[model samples]
Target: MSTDTQHGESSLLIQLQHGLKREQFERALHDIRAGWNRRELWMTLGLHDVRQRYRRSKLGPFWITLSMAIMVLALGLLYGQIFGQDLHDYLPFLAAGFVIWGLIASLVNDGCQSFILAEGMIRQLNAPLSIYAYRGLWSILIAFAHNIWVFLGVALWFGVDLNWNLLWVPVALLVLLLNGLWMALFLGLVSARFRDVPLIVGSVVQVLFFITPVIWKPEMLPGRALWLDLNPFYHLVEIMRAPLLGQAPALANWLPVIAITVVGWAVALFFYSAYRWRVAYWV
Candidate 1:
């Protein structure tokens, strides 16, 4: 009995010696690095998601473009009437606002749930939290591409010119992509922990729409609307819209978005690094 008891104690000591806190950190690093290497997984998964989204529909991918165009037309006409604006002048403006805001909103709304949406694959594979962030980014890219139809329709209707200023469009999109990743990283972790983020985000976004200059022109408000100067989202939207209107975006617009991005990314990196493990468990 003494020999058997000693053997049991020795076995536990061996196990404890083998299991160190350093090993836990190393394992976590490995998972994060593996995730980085498999970055393509997010792109692939995003494509699969896009395909699955319209798989059963007769129109397939075109459905996304067609649907967005329909929405822009319906909403522009309805809201322009409600606001007592000229349909011709307001339609293009409304189209630009709607499409850009849709991309931003989708990034915020779905980005939070990115990990939750990708849980099945995350479980099967050892990867980095960044992949889920990329998945959310790619999803927004797909939607934004589809939303281009709103611009085409607006241009056709109002002769909205796309000139050299339009070149800024890509730069604006890059800024948007950066913001999307940061939001996905931060919000994704929060949603995993709380499970109520989607609902709260939805309600907040709905209110934010009326507060934003989507249907109404910024000029409609006096000095108070200058408050938009402080909102990074307002600047992000303006940078995208100004070029489409063949004008340089206000220099005032650039700083806020960049500042928000710098601070947001720093916060996001820490949040993702810390909460990444909890995400796996939550999933």
Candidate 2:
């Protein structure tokens, strides 16, 4: 608290700022690497978030599975009748797509709050900012872990083929998680600076749910509309859903997802490198 000590601290802070300016990208990479090294901390925090959200509820996290099962059953039955599709086929497809969609939707929606929700920690802790991104992604993955059971049950009931193609599921999930990380970094940074971003993101996600092939098959569209080809969510979901349903996702599906993942990371890393230092103040 002495004047000399205060002056020295201020000088060090200024020097740190100048260093960050000159090595912004390196600093961003360092943050990510450091965050990974502290996975135990974020993983514990993420698991704590899941448990805390369901505290005192008898069903606890199983509620995720139950709710997803109910939605899939209701939609599968109604849509099967309406579209004249076989219940056997439609239900499994719906279950798989809905489960994958749940992961993607939660990642994007929760990514918006990745930094904002950690405002106190961000301000007080001298930890890597990327930890918040990892924490948010881990929490959503926990939810997805629960939700996947719904699809497994439906697949069992429908006798959906489980073949070698199913191995692709882990790869698809890895790709999705990579996409989720960038989304958390990018969206979290932007959302920290703009309070309205979460609301806008939520609205957009809801709209995308309908437009994406969650409730309907792509072939349901006559000639497979051009827009379906362009819908990134369609490809994202297909990459996961196809494997769960015992089909290897076509190159068509993998191509768009790969392209999106690359472009998204580039954009995310650029903004994250430039503005990561400002997040503590913004949040």
Number of the top-ranking candidate, with lDDT as the measure? 2
Task: Judge candidate 1 at residue 101 and give its lDDT.
Answer: 90
For residue 252, what is the lDDT in candidate 1?
Answer: 83
Question: Candidate 1's residue-wise lDDT over 161-221, tens digit each?
Answer: 7789989988998998889878887888788768898789988888877788888888778
Give lDDT: candidate 2, residue 15: 41
Instruction: For candidate 2, report its TM-score.
Output: 0.92
Distance from true position, residue 82, model 2, in Å? 1.4
At residue 141, give the lDDT of candidate 1.
94
Question: What are the runs in model 1 whose C-alpha is more than 4 Å off?
Answer: 1-37, 224-226
- Write one digit per residue (lDDT tens) for candidate 2, span 24-119: 989999999999999999999999999998999999989988999999999899999999999889999999989999999998999999999999
TM-score of model 1 (CA atoms): 0.85
Clashes of each: 1, 0
**Residue 274's lDDT in candidate 1:** 54
Q: After superposition, how far is residue 17 of candidate 1 from its true place, in Å?
A: 22
**Relative to the true structure, how large is the alpha-carbon lDDT of every model?**
0.78, 0.91
